[model samples]
Target: MLAASLAAGGFTADPAQLESPLGYFALYGDCTRLGNVLAALEQLWALRRHDINVKKHPAWYFTQRTADAALRLAERERLDPAEVRSIRVTMEPGGWIR
Candidate 1:
């Protein structure tokens, strides 16, 4: 299930770590890891160029930014909602990018 959670956020997890939470903590402790992961996740959103960085904006603006980005990306990618298995719109709460 960890793999699937990572995939939902547009990340691929190591198979060897499938059963171990420690695999996560070790990678997470690296200073460069989060930025690298966020960069990878941005590729999944075709509308990234249009969306506001929610963290930089007011917290109340989050829902609108997320919904707009999802709609735009879905349209831009010519996505079929029925066939789409996963789409990530929200950042993890308190998950700082800086």
Candidate 2:
């Protein structure tokens, strides 16, 4: 419906195109497309304040928290970096990048 509206408004695009890697990145390339997307969202009443827990310094806060937790866990378990084989860090989808 959003795509249909956008197309009627002269901004034709396959909504599923954004699911592709290149199409996903293409979203950030055009201001017109971005504005059209916002407008479509507004028309569909899909735009809202979903992020209730806003942070002032998200990057710094998360990085510091992660470091602190890792250090505490390592100390508690007597983990030696030299003896450690691998370390895995998981992040929420889209959180791995900007």
Best-performing candidate as measured by TM-score? 2
lDDT of 1 at 89: 59
**Model 1 lDDT at residue 49:** 55
Instruction: Report the lDDT tens digits of candidate 1 across residue range 1-98.
Output: 66667789999657756234466635544323556546655775634753535453334444556766777888999989999897655566864443
What lDDT does the true structure give each of the candidates?
Answer: 0.60, 0.60
Error of 2 at 78 (Å): 1.1
Q: By summed lDDT, which 10 consecutive residues of candidate 1 come out lowest? A: 52-61
* Model 2 misplaced regions, further than 4 Å: 1-61
lDDT of 2 by residue, 1-98 (tens): 66667878999667757544467536544424556556655653343442224344334444555666778899999999899897777655555453
Please provide TM-scores, in order, for all candidate models, with all chains considered together. 0.30, 0.33
Q: List the residue pairs that clash in candidate 1.
A: none
| Candidate 1 Cα outliers beyond 4 Å, as residue runs | 1-61, 92-98
lDDT of 2 at 47: 39
